[model samples]
Target chain A: MAPEERLIAVGVSHHTAPLEVRERLAVAADSIPTLLTRLRDDGFSNETVLLSTCNRVELYSVPGVRGDANGLARWLAETGGVMGRDVESTIYRLHDQAALHHIFRVVSSLDSVVLGEPEIVGQFKKAYRLSQESNAAGPVMHRVMDRALAVAKKVRTETNIAREAVSVGRAGVELARQVLGSLEGRSALLIGAGDHGKVVARSLLGYGLTEIVVANRTFGNAVNLAQQFKGSAIPLHEVERYFPRVDVVICSTGAGKILIDRDQLAGAVSKRRGRSLVMIDLAVPRNIDPGVNDLGGVYRFDLDDLAQIAGRGKEAREVAAEEAERIVESESERYWRQIMNEVVTQRIGTIVQTADAVRVAELERLRSTLDGLEPDQVAAVDAMTRAIVKKLLHQPLHQVRTWAREGEIESVESLFTAFGTRKEDDV
Target chain B: MGSVLTIASIVTILVPVRARRLAQKNNAPGGIAAHRNWEFVAVGLILLGLLLMGMQSDVLPMLTVQGGLRTLALFVAIGWLVLRRKEKMAAAGMILLPMAAVLLVSSLLEPPHAVATSVGSPFFTTHVALVFLGLGGFALSFALSTLFLIQRRRLKRKQFEDIGQLPSMETLDLLNFRTQCLGFAALTAGVAMGVFLLTQSASGRGLGDITVWGTCAVWFWYAAGLHARVVLGWRGRTAAVFGVVGFGSLGAVLTVVTVVFGGWHGS
Candidate 1:
């Protein structure tokens, strides 16, 4: 047997760890190349892709030698500044087919904290690219990553697994579009120029939002982001002044106090003459007042409210997720079967070479005698000998293919021995 | 052959219901593909039904009650195929497929009379074609309005199940407005042609016929809707409600005039 190279995976996900733990373990996008290089330097795995997102941080690897999971787990602990046992307690280790299945699920977003969220696939792609760039990905990693991505695409095309927006940024955009009908000819005031606020602004812009006003505590950062979208920037204090003029408000500031209170929104509603206003608070401390939703013309959605909508989105994708899982399972099985066939074909190379050598020796011995015959007779003899060689090898080759397909390596070994070819000789 | 069409239409109706249930169960994409396939089959069957109808008659008259209903159903089916090409309009099949099936069944149940009661002139045929085609546009507007209402309600309730699959309220309202505009124009041309044909025939019934007055009333009602929408900038719920009312009235009048009176001009 070709020393069975095992595909392994170890990870700390939202399911196994808290947000703080995930954050501590999260690898920055710029650091991925260095991290992958370091993993190889530390002799953790021969091939690897490190995927780190807000919801999960996972390492998928193909080991150069058997039982390399422990070393990889230790490396993960060191990277996160935690004890080995602490990381081990929270980490999940999967081997072979289980490891492959987990990778497919992760890439497909089936294993995401928010089921069917689309970010994971992009994150996975980035990790694969970084791994390749760092020379951490080899043939095994290439095969697994390629199949994982193909499976993800198949799931997306053949199923409705990612039909809805499960993230707050997108769900907020969806709510705004639903309420206000269209974003065309509509203006939005983003209350913070932070990352989440930028995401929300982008989502709104995708819906043809005509105008955007970006407001942040730091006026320079606000101006920078506003320039990107061809919009104006305002200081944080002027959010209420811009509120009535804008139809949507997306706030993600780090402010401790409520930025838009009920009184502020109620006054804005009157100023706008009861035109609908959509408020989304993506801040951790809740930037918009919850009481603002009670106002007749003001619609408010906090992170929790967005989560509720995302939950509904998740519910609507459950059936499609099931269908996606089946696709992943079948693809993974087919991939493993292909890998096994290649390995078996490699093992049987010497037997085929031996048969070829015998046929060539006999043909060479008869070549001299056939030289006395006509040129056509010599050509005929060559053709007959080639046919004989093919017929002689056909049964054995068929048995080898069938045995490899059935995963019967022992039968293959016995069959080789019966043919007077030892497995060691093939090596 | 007609029975085959009926069976196909029934299957088409059931497919959308299944698609809706699948969407509710969260496999909306699969449901959408299946619904689209069944609708294509329904369109083929409807064309076959028209072929059978043509074989039965010397001329393929779309003005006859049965022909009008089937042709209208065909338009609706084709409309749905076009609309459902957008992901946001995928849910349209659940509403439209069944409406098409109902019209198909209505056409099947009430076959047109073998002998023509009304005068068959080129002008009369053109008028009938225009009028039914206009009605088909009205039917499309009605379906869009219904979708807008459902989408609006879901948004109000914060239910995001169909929100992603449904077009925004603005899109639906705009589509409804455009279709109704076309329908209004066609109806105006159709009614004008009818008046000319009536004068030429000298039927003597003149404006006394219920068909003449009723057609005028229905046309004026839809024309008012178009007027309110375009000139006054009326939209959203107002336009949606007008679409439902205007199309509903046209449907009621057509049903009564065609089935009860048994004549093109209420003879």
Candidate 2:
């Protein structure tokens, strides 16, 4: 069988698994090449691509002779150092058309934690690139991934699903704009220079924030983050000192206790003299004191609040999302059909070539008897034999295509074998 | 004909208000564009009504109460249109449009009075026009301040879902400050012209009259508010509060002088 005919996908995503399961299965970018090589060398798949993002850890592969969907799932579980039984329920396995549809949906971000997010496309491209570097993905994966990317591009251009701020950091930025008006001359203080805080700071800068002040538990991290924006950094302990000057304060630290209390924010508000302040708390276990929200001239939003804002964006893009789903559905169906047709054509060509070889061998044996005939008569005999061979092969070729279309692949293989066409005969 | 146009303008303004509410409900951008387009149509209707009133009147429209109310609506509409050009000031229309509608309705309610032929001097005419223009400024400031307070409340309460399309509190405060300054200057000049005419005439109207005291009181209130904003750095909630109160007092004094005490300035 061709590698494309044995396509399979096994994964645990945000929808099917909890965050803990996904985290366990998630592979780092630097580790992806090793994983891809292992997948191919260990005989799990002939061609494979590993897509490991924060929201999902998916493996798209075409299994080899010793490989199957269950084997791929077990391999994934072994890589994560988890028991197969522990993740068996969460691991979703798809095959053939269903697998292709899932790939299209994932590349288009329709299967993301946040619908229509743009980050998934880049992550998918990076995964495909790493697969190529590892020499694990061959022509089959290249064709599938390239077509997936084209579908994603079409969905992005033809729909408005990605037009609004659906991600948490971006939604927080939108809420900040609502409270603080224009951010052109405004400044933001980012507490704990972590990835989430960096993302929020980048969004704020994108919306025209002039300055960013970073404060981290580690002073070097703070300095590094601040230098990226040409801003300043302060010690984590001195965050309250800069509160009165900045228009927004984003708290994304990992500290388990309250960082800023009501009294500290009250003092800041007093110094601000009625200038509005927006506080976004993106940390878990509640970094900033929730009571600080009661202070006048101060607006505070935590993760749940940001999620609600993001939900509003999702609601706004519902119409666009419907359009995108239709595009994915139609594109996947068309692409799958084309792939099936190519397989059918290859099988039919093999059958025809075997029959023609038989005819040529028989005609060679009759060359002695044809030596007495004229050149024109000899040509007629050759043409009549070729016509006879074509007429004899027509019904079998038609039946092969019909069986392929009806998904009776076993019957098609039996017919090909009965006609003396072997797998090794494919050129 | 003027009343018809005014009513049509009020109805037109309601279209954008409804569109705004629908937009907020559905979280759609198309509704907002529709709201903005309809708002323009509403303002155009107000302008057309004002032009019709101008062409029909023999003397200046500022000579009577109905004309004064119509003039107030026109000025408020014009002020709203001008501010709408600079920013997303659509939320201000929630208050400003209803205020204009009330002015128009009030004009329709008032009994028609003869135009004062003896008060035909250009000085008196310019004074009345400036006073109404100043009141127009106050009305716009009041609308902006009201929106500022609503937005402030939404923020303080952390009711982000209800914020809708209101401008930032800083933008509202700044626009209120500018409008207050313009209103104060125009009222000051108009009051000066009233004082000059009072001194030259034998009409017996002076500072002792309740209307004169009332007008002066309105002037002093806005003057103090503007002074606090500029000199003491009083802004945001404070400036918005002052705007609301100043306009309230001005409305009260106008009602008492016109409705209870009859006309002022020896009318």
Candidate 2 regions with alpha-carbon error over 4 angstroms = A1-165, A316-427, B1-59, B114-118, B161-164
* Residue-wise C-alpha lDDT for candidate 1, range B1-267, written one tens digit per residue: 665776677677568667767777895466545555777777887878778877877666366667778888888888788877765776666777778888878877876753243446777777877887788788889889888778766655566665777776767877888889878888889999988877776557657667777789889998888886666656766788888888888878878877777755753
The local lDDT score (0 to 100) that residue A274 gets in candidate 2 is 67
DockQ of 2: 0.30
Checking candidate 2 for backbone clashes, the offending pairs are none
The regions of model 1 sitting more than 4 angstroms off are: A1-167, A177-186, A192-199, A202-210, A215-230, A234-247, A251-278, A281-300, A312-427, B1-8, B12-35, B58-60, B114-118, B259-264
List, residue by residue over A75-106, the lDDT tens digit for candidate 1. 78778787757667898877767788899889
Q: RMSD in Å for candidate 2, one decimal? A: 10.6
User: Which candidate leads the pack in lDDT?
Assistant: 2
| Highest TM-score scorer | 2
Candidate No. with top DockQ: 2
What are the lDDT figures for the candidates, one per model?
Answer: 0.76, 0.80
Per-prediction DockQ comes to 0.13, 0.30
With a 3 Å backbone cut-off (N, CA, C), the pairs that clash in candidate 1 are: none
Residue-wise C-alpha lDDT for candidate 2, range B1-267, written one tens digit per residue: 878887888787677767777876797746667566666777787778767776887666666777777788878877887887766687787677778778877777775453343366889888888888899999999998998889878776667775756777777888999999888899999999888878877766685677779989999999999887677667888889999999999989877766877655424
